[model samples]
Target: MRILLAAALLLTSAPVLAQQSPAKTMTASQDAFLRDYAETRRFMSGRPVNPRITPDEKTVLFLRGQPRAPIQTLFAFDVATGEAKEVLTPEAILKGSEETLTSEEKARRERMRVSARGFTSYQLSEDGERILVPLSGKLYLVERVSGKSTELKTGPGVIDPRFSADGQQVAYVRDNDVFRLEVASNKEHRVTTGGTPAKTHGLAEFVAQEEMSRFSGWWWSPDAKFIAYTESDTGQVEKLSIIDVMHPEKGAEDYSYPRPGKNNAKVRLGITPVTGGKTVWVQWDAEKYPYLATVMWPKKGPLTVLVQNRTQTEEKLLAVDTASGKTKELLTEKDDAWLELEQTFPVWLEDGSGFLWYTERNGGPEVELRNADGSLARSLVKPEAGFRNLARYIEKDRTLYFVGGPNPTESYLWRVKDGGAPEQVRPGTTGEAVEGGSVARSGNLAVISHSSPTSMPRTYVVRGDGSRVGELPSVAVEPGFVPVVEYREVGPLKFHSSLVRPRNAKPGQKLPTIVEVYAGPTVTVVHKSMAAHLLSQWMADQGFLIARFDGRGTPMRGAKWQRAVHLDFSGVTLEDQAAAVQALAAVVPEVDLQRVGIEGWSFGGYMGALAALKRPDVFKAAVAGAPVVDWLDYDTHYTERYLGLPQQHPEAYEKSSLLTYARDTSKPISPLLLIHGTADDNVYFFHTLKLSDALFRAGKYHELLPLSGLTHMVPDPLVTQRQHEWVMNHFKRHLAK
Candidate 1:
């Protein structure tokens, strides 16, 4: 299944070229562009990513890589002087040795879709004096005052290392078990025992990490007295082996994978003291709410956990009593469809007054303040306020910072203070259109990262009164050209749409178009930022127009819009793509209706293949990459949430599956190029093979390309460049005017 994220084609019965562009060698500029785009991770490198303000509000910490490299190093920006200093790098710690990754670390990186090396992540101490940087499986503690780092005596293969609240000690997972190490003395204590490959402690289950985005399974108490962690038993789950086709001699790596109707890993939450005593298992009805969605250990409130039922339509927020191992129900959220998890919520106030919660009860998501007992205190953000997620809550002044805007494509900084209405936060505004912005606030200080259609993301430090302080430095390379994109709302439903044409196109030219689509839940593709269209513009420069949109079954429009594909993935998703293309063509005559193509990856890959099979009148050629052929082959959490149990709603799976269409000989299959990574553990390569086999048996013509040793993400820059070239050639051959 697609991670609710990221991205053309033509249709024909047999391979026939009509007015196809001449096959030519790459130009110097084009070759340079491809290399730079792939190597820089689509121009995202060297950006101050994941910025966090230190507790003292004196420095802002971020990770930045070389302008053309993927490896990131930690940097600190002195807020007072606007000076940036490198804190740590993998090279400094490794002393010129090559960085190596454990099998566990590789799997974790795949789950997180992280390709960067060096310091991919770090943990900051609460006191803001020290930073914990985990590099290639080892831990290093870097002091804020001195630019020196000390390697903790803990053994290698550390997975998730976190700092205790007091910064005196550190906790991490190694060999599937939780361990604690005193920072000063290096005294280590095993927090849990009897951990094996099948039964692991202090780690999230596959579904939790891949689907729910809950990367960590352990939490430290505010007082640093206890550690709350999860024990996951995956003995009942089916073990699937993924072989590295390029290195088969290394043997297959077997992993516990739960399909749509299979048994998931049994996970239990437990709390143990830092001194390593008996674990107190939190009490809850695990049989009903089997999915542990989120865990919160706030500074002033009881430890809280959010759990969901198998269907994901119901969930509960329970506050745990550490002493008795008991839990009290705090809140219950239900939806006819799957309930979306809010990443930041249940923020307990320092004064123990109430907690902030995000809910979709008012048609769209809004913020609400709930009493300590979980009853509603008041609605802070209503449906019309365009509330997104809570960014921060300053307890001293009782101010809430959030992200939202007038439309789904826009994200602006918004704030509410002292029971006042939501107001737009225009920090150092000069009337330029800030397409989207995010706030990283600490106390009265904030770092606003805003972007527009013409520029890359720019960061500004601001005072409490919205006065500019200083700018965080970014070394990201400019793509050298602003993407010429037109945002539109097409179709009767007003589908959020975008169009990109060649920069030098003639006014009356009806260009062959490629409909780029994800059409998946939990993500929106049409955005107001220029970075979102760099690749689109590059593709358009290859003599084709680009049309993309967020159709039904996408988020931010409300529950009903997102749930449109609940039981009909292929039908609704493909229908929306075709309808959106036609609707856009009606208003924009430059979009050639007779010469159109479609392309996508993951869920979009599924849609691309489905379109060629069902809507040949629309999409002429398709490129399906790492596509899910059948819903039953996908994981339990994501698949079942939309299609229900395979045992109960087999029809939904059958109707939505490409295999169902491959078996039917009523129509000729449209031209297709199927791509899959042979070692993809997420949507396994078998999905593509099975569909190819079915299509071949049914006498369908298609092309299948297997990427050897590649996981779900093909992160290698050279391979990425080659892949895009193949896609462009395929589109040029089939989508010609």
Candidate 2:
């Protein structure tokens, strides 16, 4: 069933290549120029490119694509020999069925189809003998010499497979339980058992995966002798059920989610031996440190676990001796609001006596080298003013790469040594270069660079001294497609929007402007990048002016921009968006303010609902999915960060809630379509339910799309397609007249 869903998402949309220039094609001289450009661009852009250097610094691996096919295959380039060889090919992995399959089988096949455009997680073995690839819930081991691949296991719902250092074992998760597979014997053994329903083992819930940015469940130790994982018990969490009314076979699903100020999932850490035995639970003093953010295994003998308290402001890094189970506090960090958890994996030093740490304590984020005993070795990458967040750290050479925004709307990449003022690397005035990844081992460098308003991704290789070596070919863009019409406007007539305009736009045609918003404190909507969403483009192609802007409360800049919406989240974001729209309407006469529409999911959904009610003069139509109407109904960790506790700030919470303004929406205002999944745990399905009831009692009319068997993150492709189609139809009926 999961495979079918995955296939549906993959096969649902076909790539529509825009027309390219004839000169865009690479010439012999142009190819050489591109090579140099890719190299120079890598250093200048501060992005990870090709020729990925290994920890040992001797070997380098890169991805090479055939110009004829749409797919890209992985290739290893030996810098020493100046030669490149193809390592993995789709032909080698894809086999069995050659004939055109049935519609159902085609759907399944599409789900299984791996795209070169999509990111694939591949890790080389410690010995560099084989590579582990997780494909379609199955682990595949590919030999370097013969390119021979063998499926290790085909378990029910398996992901995040990691190879042991000795390359003798492979560990993965199945049905929320961690398991280890013996390579030679092909035997699977469960390391952790007893997974309760709605609860998870070695993995995070949906909200944590998306909002908190957690993916992998289990972590391999330095010596590969033990594994540490997290367990979440959601039995006490609030349960929301959804019934899929649109499906031919109606089914119901119940999701346990912790909404704001509600019960949360209890989390704990445990360790298991690779050879298979009883797991040991790591005990923690709840009063001192209750939440487990991350656990690091600096050395095999003693495991260092970093735990954050329930308040999230205080963090303690505890060194637990695996032999005696004795724990000692190594370091502690605190903040007024909350300390940002190190979402990425921590890099341990060679000797394991100390490790690298990053903190946003002194106004902005900075890197600090700390000993295992918890004392700070030195402060690295300190800024005199403004906020700087460490993006990546190349520990081998003691260099740190970071993203800094002097202001909230703009961002740039900067680099510095272990302790120094960061030198600006990728300096830009308008759009931001979204740095993907950086691989700097043994002085050879590579970076992936892409900016807003461009679809092509360029790769570059740099030297140890930050000089360009060479550049890879540009990502092929379809030919003949030209963007001419301006879709949306912002600020004033001088400030033209960066939204992609439709090529077939007619003159004097006033298109309906659809605003996509996720007005939240933790995130921002505006980012300068060429990475386009297909759905956003589809709306534009259907003759809608799509525009998105980050309201107050979004991060990335300084405290003022983010804190502006504090204690007034919903109202502040809505007002900013409303003002931006009014300004845009005054400048861009092509946009019909009377036909303006807004749509969003989650926090954005909440904003859309509020905008339609609060600023009926601007937004004529709204589509909200899984919205939070009341702040009191949401979870503690997120809501408390902004509005404080409901008990402490009752007036603030009441004013910010959409439910308070629902009664004042008697006037014939914008038409609204509220969609929600019954099993939504994050925002809770009750938010929509209560809003629907409130509107009905107030004699207000609105459309409701209640789905069953769906969670906060809608999984069904059919439902997603229907949702978008309904939104487009609504805009076409009202805006495109």
Q: In terms of lDDT, which candidate is strongest?
A: 1
- The CA lDDT at 401 in model 2 is 70
**Residue 241 lDDT (model 1):** 94
- The clash tally of candidate 1 reads 6
Residue 18 error for model 2, in Å? Answer: 35
Cα TM-score per model? 0.95, 0.76
Model 2 lDDT on a 0 to 1 scale: 0.62
- For each candidate, the alpha-carbon lDDT, in order, equals 0.84, 0.62
Question: For candidate 2, lDDT tens digit of each residue in 69-174?
Answer: 3344566655455455667755566564221222222222223332232114566877778877654455678887687888776574566678887788888767
- Which ranges of candidate 1 are over 4 A from the true structure? 1-26, 427-442
Please give the lDDT score for candidate 1.
Answer: 0.84
Per-residue alpha-carbon lDDT of candidate 1 for residues 1-737, written as tens digits (9 for 90 to 100): 11111112222233734433323534567668888888888888888877888888888898988888878999888888989888888898999998888888888888999989888998888888999999988999999898789999887899999998889989999899989999889777888888888989998889999998898889999988899999999999999998866566888889999999999999999999878789999999999999999999988888999989999999999999998889999999998877878767778887666799888876888888899999998887777766776778876776778777658887777788865787767744332344333454444677788787787888877776667788878898889688998998999999999899998889879899998889999878888778888888888988889989898899888778888988779877788888899999899988898889888999988988998888888888998999999889899999999998889889999999999998888887777888888889999999998888888888888877677767789887876887787778788878874
Least accurate 10 contiguous residues by lDDT in model 2: 3-12
